[model samples]
Target: MREGKRLGRVIWAPVGAAVLSGLVIGAAARLLMRGIALAVGGLTGMSLAGTVGILVVFVVLALPAAVTATARPVIMHAGRWVTAALTGLMAARTGVSDAKIIVLADDGQLTPITVLIVAFAAIVVLHGRLAQYLTRRLRTLPESPAEVLPTPDARPV
Candidate 1:
């Protein structure tokens, strides 16, 4: 029982981090989307603004995922999973009637949960690929020495 408790605590670190990161990132994404929408709408027109804003948000959000994927793929994967879960929870909390919106007539509509799932999947794939490419590129580059060898006179006592 004690061992099980210890294992549970160890497992919870990544799980907690994933959930916290997801919640924070989701809120940031929403705010970014909203701000972009308002700015674009005011500058251009409503219809185009909505489309452009969403595109911008997706692109912008993907960048961090790509970076995190490179630095820590596990964290990125966990974050994506948590994001999807949170989206579902939020949708349920809001009630079914208000959870979905029509994006296109013939193409079909999507709920917030669906959008988040799609976005998270896209981010994971894109970031994973980008990270791989970057790693390859880095490997091909010549290594630089960390520092000049310490001179005999300069050596510490």
Candidate 2:
């Protein structure tokens, strides 16, 4: 029983961390997508409601991608499932049935999946690089001695 409890504790911490990180990344991605949608909609003279719907659609599609791209493998796989479910719900709510949008092209023609693949690849690479940089920076910080450690005069005889 004790061993089982210990194992549960060890397992739960990483799972909890992954979930928390996924939620945070999802929210950040939603905000970023919302801002981008708002800017594009404004430039193209889309209606306010239309812009909001665009943002909603972006959030639905991008959140999971961002989380999966940035998170650990287990979380990444789970994020795909979560994304599919949310895409359905958001599509229903926003009246945007299709989640796929082709935005990039070459030779004056639209390239079906190339743009999306590149964008996701860029996002994943950027996220991974940023995480590595932050981890390296954190590792290089000097550790301070604990206050509980005995000083020369405080040492036991």
- The C-alpha lDDT values of all candidates are 0.42, 0.43
Cα RMSDs of all predictions?
A: 12.4, 9.5
lDDT of 1 by residue, 31-144 (tens): 433443343232323356655554343334333333343346686665444434444444344333332332221232234435644554454344334433443344333333
User: What residue runs in model 2 are displaced by over 4 Å at the alpha carbon?
Assistant: 42-157
lDDT of 1 at 89: 47
> Top model by lDDT, which number?
2
In terms of lDDT, the poorest run of 10 residues in model 1 is 101-110
- TM-score, cand. 2: 0.33
lDDT of 2: 0.43
lDDT at position 64, candidate 2: 52
Listed in order, each prediction's TM-score against the native is: 0.29, 0.33
Of candidate 2, the 10-residue stretch with the lowest lDDT total is: 96-105
